[model samples]
Target chain A: MEESPTIYEQIRTSGYSRRDFLKFCAWVTAFMGIEASGIGNVVRAMETKHRLPVVWFHFQECTCCSESFLRSSHPIVAEIILDKLSLAYTETLQAAAGYQAEEVLYNTMKKYKGEYLMLVEGSVPTDNDGVYCCIAGKTSLDIVKEAAEGAKAIISWGSCASNGCIQAANPNPTGATPIHKIIKNKPIINVPGCPPIGEVMAGVIVYLLTFDRIPELDGMGRPKAFYSRRIHDTCYRRPNYDAGLFVESFDDESARKGYCLYKMGCKGPVTYNACAVTKWNNGVSYPIKSGHPCIGCSEENFWDNGPFYQHLASFPGFGIETTADDIGLAVGAVTVAGIAAHAVRANIKKRKLINADIEESKKEGGE
Target chain B: MEDQKIKRVYVWEIPVRIYHWLNALVVVTLAVTGYLIGNPLAIQSSAEAYLGYWFGTVRFIHFVAAFIFFFNFLFRIYWGFAGNKYADWKNFIPYTKKYIRECYDVLKLDILHIKVKPFISVGHNALAGLTYFLTFLAFLFQSITGFGMYSAMSDSFFPKLFAWVVPFLGGDFAVRQWHHLMMWFFIIFAVVHVYIVFYHDYVERRGVLSSMAGGWKFIEKDKPT
Candidate 1:
């Protein structure tokens, strides 16, 4: 950590002006939802602060989070933080290999003890003695537990690391578990998505480095600045949802007209992410912008929620696939039928009892 | 009939009666709107999106009714403590051995048909009381899930209180599933509840069904020895 240059030194060496660095600081400050006064503090901290060491661990993941991070939307993110963070050891980006790579990872673990930030990219598989996912003969579960012990704090880079994304979906064969489930002591910031938006990924890191503390988190341990509002709240097609103008199918005219994808199971209503606002691929277009429904990748157990192509008419729960209305109509019909049967029997039985009482009264009166 | 004397008993108090009817209306409204929300009507119009706020209006009605339902439930809870002896809190819970026995007795008569007559209680029978208590628990569940989902849409502190439920229950989808399923619970409860009330009115010759409306139940007096 001490050997690396501060972010300010990196900018100075790159021949960028003080104004450029100030602008960068202000941009991150705004993303953090900090007041205008906080920009100065961010600048002061960045100029004096030593480059924080980061260890990015990849396990049962697709490396999309790394892709999103490297291709971050922010103009300065790819250039500044990428170079400034002093990535001590990352499986995907590092050039070293074999024992040399393993040696760097171990040395960083020792030298940066209680100081290095650990960014976990995926879940740790724990089934069958963690045989499902192994790296260099060590199970993900064992490696993560060992690596987590000396970390300053942990950042779950995507839904894979946050809530056991797809691998930990229903009937999870690998017994894949998220980092938080395995490491309880460290403060974890879960930036969840199939792959979180590039800007959001960059924002989390910038917030951590600038503030030297985790940002305000929501109940889900996600940064409140990005995850507090559902995608529906900020969606541009919101008027269409509110108007009930929806695309019934992908080939429908409404699809060309840009109607809301909600009817086609757009999970934008339930999904919390910066995708709607930030957009993907340098704010060019997102899946929703291209007429595809949001899959709610950021949410927990999203894969098991239901089919992505269908709306909320049905879901799998109660040990069977059924909907509320289907069960309601069936139970209602049966209950009415049963009641009709009960009424006839009850009336007939009551008549007999009443007549018997009348006869007994007559006998008593005659006596 | 000629040898019997009848007495009129005031069982349901005015507040309790009002709460009952209001709750029924709100529950019906909520169920209908809630179902539609889960499965939108798919009304396709060539008109611009601004021309129709049909779905928005439906949601507005639901939110308003939800607020009314929530407050009405709170009022009933207060009435349970403040109202007359028949509408007292003690009746809702099976607090004693006798209460449980009466529930079993009502079950035997109404359900098993082992007895030929209706179980008589000026207020709700023990079985109905206990069942209604369970629905109250369902009411709590629905409110939590309802407001929990609403928290995402609104920034109000009241709704925000239930925000933790989303993550706790896995997510919005799981919460919505439970909320939707519970709607059927109320509907089924209403079906059986109405039937039993009418069945009692017929069998017992008491104003059981009308008692909820007019607050009077005709009780047969002691027979001449």
Candidate 2:
């Protein structure tokens, strides 16, 4: 192994200082929800470890994932994640073009075979020999397969790469397919979202660096730590949900009260992601916090779930019992009806007894 | 015994009664607020016309009521074991064969419009008892899922305890939809309850409405068991 260089030395040589390096590490630790004690491990890894060789590929996508990553507020994210990491080849970010870019990709594949990480953005189109999406006269499907053959691990960025997003929504023209659906042999981690929260992206990378392996994932291949809870679970407006307060319209009194947007077609209850707690724009606020209902963008096939603003009456939960919309309506209506019926039933019995007593009193008086 | 003598028998303990009424109140509030929120039928204007928050007030009241409802839930559970015999598990469950017979008789009479008068229990009748039992079960369901959703934040004890519901219910999306729909059941239940109470009071000429308030329901001597 090559001798490891200290991060401060690396950053200083790259024109940064010890304080700046430590601050960046602390920020990373906070973002990742790691303990203060874990800071040492993070620092050590960054200082001694050589940047992992990464090959980023773009397929049938709008390049939003790249845009979201670059928009990350943490300067170190750009400085270290982009600058320090050995990003060997990326079609969007790379300056070299034509044969030069192709040469760099080939050289990296040969030099770090079965060692480099493969990052895929967007979906792979498989229609007509994958003619819909191509790079340098080669189909995206062909390129992905060739590059994936020697990758150590694959990370599917955003819903496009993770679940095909809108490209695979309905009547898919390009036959857009998620990475795992096409290539299942290699270990894959899906970071799903509509341009997933920036911190989440950063956190995933940090976890990989610190643990030297992929984080535990749910059955869908999403990291369990970040994707386990629904956005409804962590929403700031959740109290309104439990209380049964809801916004009737975008301009109603309840909406002003910051009631749960659930009734207004907020998909938070069903969607899982870290947007509510971790938030966006640097932990400042999320869509729900800003009074917008969750579109459930983090979930797979969110594009086809339904219209964004129509409320769903009921759905099955964990099969504990169906809390159907009609059930609530039934209970509400039945409780009142049942109570009144019982009251009437009781009265009829009571009146019969009172009338009988009156007759007995009259008889005794006559006797 | 002296004529016109009155004796008081405890029908509901303090917490039990408190929980009962407050739960009723919140469920009603939730149904109303939930209805407005879900359909937004009450709103006639555009989203931007009213400061961008359409049903904000209803939702606020709904949440406040829900808080009260959950609080009542905690008390109800405690009272089930700690309450009087009339308010305990024995009263809440429909286990006896006699109770089953009463329910059958009542149903038959309703369908046939039979005129036979019968003796009635001071407590909730068989049918009423069963409905209450189911409502209790519904309350339990609501509370579990309610906290399950709440547990998402605070990472509180309840969400972890009830985490199993997530998978069993399919996913969070389904769980949430069920939660919203259940509100409608409560709404329909409330409407029917009111209609039946007033209808009986008018036709039977008995102080049935006062029984809950005064806790004494007098019966005529001719009534047969």
Q: At residue A360, what lDDT does model 2 achieve?
A: 70
Residue-wise lDDT of candidate 1 within B1-225, one digit each (tens)?
A: 454567788888889899999999999999889878878887888888888899999999999999999999999999989999888888889999989988898888777677733446777888988998999899999999999999987868999999999989988878887888888898899889889888887766678888889999888676321
Q: Which number leads on TM-score?
A: 1
Give the per-residue lDDT of model 2 (tens digit) for B15-93.
6556667777788777777666555553333333334443556656765776678778777767778877666767667
lDDT (Cα, 0-100) at B152 in candidate 1: 85
TM-score per prediction, in order, is 0.93, 0.59
lDDT of 1 by residue, A10-39 (tens): 877877788888888888787777789999
How far residue A70's Cα lies from its native spot in candidate 1, in Å, is 1.1
lDDT of 2 by residue, A27-88 (tens): 77877777789999888887777767789898888888888888776767766667666688
Native interface contacts retained, candidate 1: 0.73
Please give the lDDT score for candidate 1.
0.86
Residue pairs clashing, model 1: none
Off by over 4 Å in 1: A1-4, A14-23, A35-37, A317-321, A353-367, B1-4, B116-119, B223-225
